[model samples]
Target: MMFKTDKQTLTDLNVLDWNSASLLRFFDHTLTLGGRDQLYNYLMHPLTTIEEIVERQETIAYLSTVNVSKLFDKYMMVDLERYLNKPAAPSVKNRTSYFLDTISFNFFSLSAQREQLLVRQSVREIAMLFTALQDIVAEAKSSGKAVGLLRIYADFFSANASVFDKEEMRQVGRGKSWRLTTHKYNYLFRGKRRPQVQELFNMIYTLDALTAVAKMWNEGGLCFPRVNTNDTAAALLRIEGLYNLALDNPVKNDIHIPSAQNIWFLTGANMTGKSTLLKSIGICIHLAHVGFPVPAQSMETILFKGLMTSINLLDNIGSGYSHFYAEVMRLKTMGEIMTVDNPVVIMLDEIFKGTNYQDAYEATLNFINSISGIESSLFFVSTHITDLGEIVGMDSCVALKHLETKADPKQGAIFTYKLLDGIATEKLGMWFLNRESVFETFRAVQPRKSSS
Candidate 1:
């Protein structure tokens, strides 16, 4: 089974985008276009099984210790890929046909001659790429790190070793005896061994993607998460020192949501890092499913069937829906998912914020009450209405938590940005208004007695 996610969840977490600041851009250090595409595919489809996820994690962990990037050149790989994908030309039957074809190309057709030259360049590129892979395999074996995906690649290269003979490739690359050996080798490569060559390039591209992920792991100081495929009733998510990667200096927070307390009713004031914390959790969950290292010191989680996040949701103007309606629809979708998929992670930031205060409070309270019965799924609901916390706090399944904020005489409100136990009682809305001088500015302007 594939891990379940949607565009809204992906957009909420900034998972895949062309923007430089996106998570995809942050981890994409692949050397070739095909490699980048492979990386994108990895991000798009996260694994559902713990075994598959662990295997990928081990492969990347091994890659992080080695310098495989030094063996590949982006341009050369790109050229080789283009050459392999090109349509193969008719092969000459014998030496007589080869000689005549060469004569015809050289004398009559400039385009044919140019094509032959390009083919020779492509042959050299392929040979160089194969040699690089050979070295990589040798390095992996000598280091005793050739296992999992690396071992598979090594085995493939070993099985096809005769085809990519170093001496023959070297001679063919040097254009030695073009009339005889070049045509024979070209026929062997482009005609007879095309499928194998394509398979080799696919492996190279996969390596490039994994190498990029490994680089991210090493550079970001990320840790591989321990994923368990237990019953949904035993779902658990615990992470220590977890923070958002986009921030230069993010405040790390510890989160622990055991199966008993499946829902966390979060309360915090505005700008108290609630949204950032939610995004960080969602990002880590998604990365864990991808078998990629998460931006955390350590983590242990059960394999979740699905993930959904409702943050920064917009109104569907074309569909004649207001923001509140959109929020309701999103919640409906999440509810539908929860019905079939147990152990799904659902995150809602400031639920029903687009509605009136009374309606928001009632809706939030009722929603929490409704979802608290679903003990298998995990829910993180952050809201400004701390009153609901007092009600939901009594529930055995609801964990009441908040981002701590302290009041300062000089600074007005100093946000600690720390996750703390208990409901938040602080209300700093008026303080924010005064600190920004919003009322004072209005008083000073006074609308200039517009009646005159």
Candidate 2:
């Protein structure tokens, strides 16, 4: 089955966005278009089985250190599929045709030149990719490392290495003058070679994607999360020293949720880094599932079937849905998913804020009670409802955590962004209002003396 997640979940996790600071962009160091597409595909559909996840993690771990040379220059690989898949162009066949073409080929020269350039690039990239794969295989064998995925790739290249080593193809691919030879040109441009060309691009992209992932792994000091897949009746999700990858200087937090605990109710004053913490956990879960290294000192979790989020929600003005109704709809959606037997991780920030205090509290409380009993699900919900925490904390399935704030009469509120046990009672909204002199501004307004 496809990895179960929606657009809103992706948005809430900040996973994919081209023009913004997204998780995908954060790790996107692809060297070619094919590699980028491959990366996107993997990110979109995370692995479900522990074996698959382990296989990928093993691949990434091994490749991260392998000093594979740069396969091609920056953005050197273009959209060559269209050119390669097209029918082979008519060429100057023999000496007689060559002479005729020299005098009268001007009409088709421009198009042919473009086509020739594309073909030459295709040949060069294919050759380079072949050589790189060969080297990778040799290294793996020589090192005597048990690399599952890399060995598969190496074997694949070994089977196809002859395609790149043919005397005619090799000379032409290397840009020797033999590329202009009619026979060699025809052989390289044969329509039959389209599949090979496509495969070569894919292999190159695979390398690029691996390299890019390795770059992130090294730069972020990331670690592979230990995935739990035993059929036992226990659930566990824990991370040590976790931090947000997008932050310049991120505060690290530890999360420990035993099998009995499902709900993590976070309470903190505004701007206490509650949302950032939620995002950090969400991102860690996502990257873990994708088999990519996560920005944490260490992490371990039971393999969840999917992920759901209700953060950064917005009302639909065009649909006539109020913010409260929109939030209700989101919860309802999660409620439907809860029926599935598969385990899932759910996050809700500032739950039920769209409605009044009483209604929001009741709704959030009821929702928490209902989902807390679900042993197959995990939750991280943040809210300003400190009163509800006392009641919710009583449930064995729920854990109450908060971000503490230090307030000084002169300094206003100083946020430590540290996660701690128990609910927070700091209502610093008034403090900020007072610090801003909101009431003083009204008092300072001059009585309309001039108008009077």
- Which candidate has the top score in lDDT? 1
What TM-score does model 1 achieve against the real structure?
A: 0.91
**Which portions of model 2 miss their true places by more than 4 Å?**
79-82, 88-121, 146-148, 161-172, 175-190, 230-235, 447-452
| Candidate 2 per-residue C-alpha lDDT over 10-129 given as tens digits, one digit per residue, 9 for 90 to 100 | 888888877557877977888777788888887877888888888888877777777764674445566455655566644645545543543464546888677556656665555555
The global C-alpha lDDT for each of the candidates, from Candidate 1 onward, is 0.84, 0.77
Q: Per-residue CA lDDT of candidate 1, range 1-452, in tens?
A: 66779999999999898887688999999988888989999999999888788878988988888777754678877777777767764676754565466556545487887777777787766666677677787788888888768787888888988776777776665556454566665666677688887887888888889999998888866999998766642348989999988888889999888788989989999999999999999999999999999999999898889999999899998999999999999999988887778779999999999999999999998998888778667899999998887788899999999999988777778888899999998998998898789988888874655684
* Model 1, runs deviating above 4 Å: 91-103, 107-109, 158-167, 170-179, 231-235, 446-452
The TM-score obtained by model 2 is 0.87
Clashes of 2: 0
